[model samples]
Target: MLAFLYPGLGHVYLREWLRALVWFFLNVTSFTLLMPADAVPETFGWSELVAAAENVTPEAALALAAITVFSMIDAYWMAKRQNTETEVEEGTTCPNCGRDVDSDLEFCHWCTERLNPESDEAEETADDSGANA
Candidate 1:
């Protein structure tokens, strides 16, 4: 909810100070840089605030909205990652085709290539002997 309202607030709540600062600065900078010169009032007040909001360009608004969305996504994912019990290990790759394969499997699932380490060494030895012959 905080992220929805004030992008990156969720990161602050989660004690991710650096991420929160980065996201908040990005959102604020996008809004400030993209906003039209005439959009902002000379003085700060309720009426001026309303006028500024009214005068904001569609591009600036869209950019800020996109930043807000990214901030929320980052916050959500950071929190989710923090809460996760364990990190998933990367899967082993098939030597024949360089495709990821299950650790328990002995062959490349995608290419049907043999993946046994001992067999691969034996084949290498046989090839070396044949070459010598």
Candidate 2:
């Protein structure tokens, strides 16, 4: 939501401070560079609109529009990536089948093999040896 509306907001929400800062800086720079040289009038009127329009360069406007669209897409992508990572963390990869599964599941969906049995046994042996020492 924030990211789509404001560049770099998604990164900030995702705790990626560096990305957020960089994105914000780039967005600001794009806007600054694209801004018209002519000063707009204090009052909103047809004359001011015409003047502003006259000062606007087509290439600059196009560049600014591109930057805005790119920022929105980047923010959405980062948000999706963060969500996918969260999902992965809450799930498990089946050792025998190499498939993603719920963390609570005990068997692999593809291979139908018991999950983590060998690793569990190895861990148990290591723990026992450490306790004995």
Candidate 3:
């Protein structure tokens, strides 16, 4: 939505400073290179803007529109990805060190504690069965 107004505004909302700047500069450069000199207005007004827009060549309009649309889509996807990442549970706590650790490993990465979850479950099951026998 914000990107519909300009290419970099959506990136700014996403807190991507670098991308925002890049997109902003790209928009300025495109306008500088593609916009007709006669289209530049000395005064600022809604009517002046409309008149200027009328002078934009079809090719330039297409390019600028494409950039804005792409920027909006990119920002939308990034926001969606951020939301998904935050919603998902991540990693595990190391029991020994009480620190965050990767869940893929069988040991606490920080304290080198054995946290072989599968083996521990198996052992517990075996112990319970044996005790019942």
Query: Number of the top candidate by TM-score?
Result: 3
User: Can you list the residue pairs that collide in candidate 1?
Assistant: none
lDDT of 3 by residue, 29-82 (tens): 998998898688779999998898788899998888888888899889888988
Tell me the tens digit of each residue's lDDT in model 1 across 1-133.
Answer: 6888998899999999998899889888887789898897999999999998999998888888888888889888988888884544454777777877887887888999877778779989999999999
Residue 30 CA displacement from its true place in model 3, Å: 0.5
Worst 10 residues of 1 by lDDT: 85-94
Query: Cα RMSDs of all predictions?
Result: 10.3, 7.7, 7.9
lDDT of 1: 0.85
Per-residue error for 6 in candidate 1, Å, reads: 1.7
TM-score of each: 0.56, 0.52, 0.62
How many collisions per candidate?
Answer: 0, 0, 0
* Model 2 CA lDDT for position 56: 79
Model 2 segments more than 4 A misplaced: 39-54, 88-133
Q: Worst lDDT window (10 residues) for model 2? A: 33-42
lDDT (Cα, tens digit) per residue for candidate 2, span 1-133? 6766777887788788998898889888877877765743567899888888788788877876676677678777877887887765533888666778877777877789888697779999999999999
User: Relative to the unseen true structure, what is the C-alpha lDDT of residue 25 in candidate 1, on a scale of 0 to 100?
Assistant: 92
Off by over 4 Å in 1: 42-47, 86-133
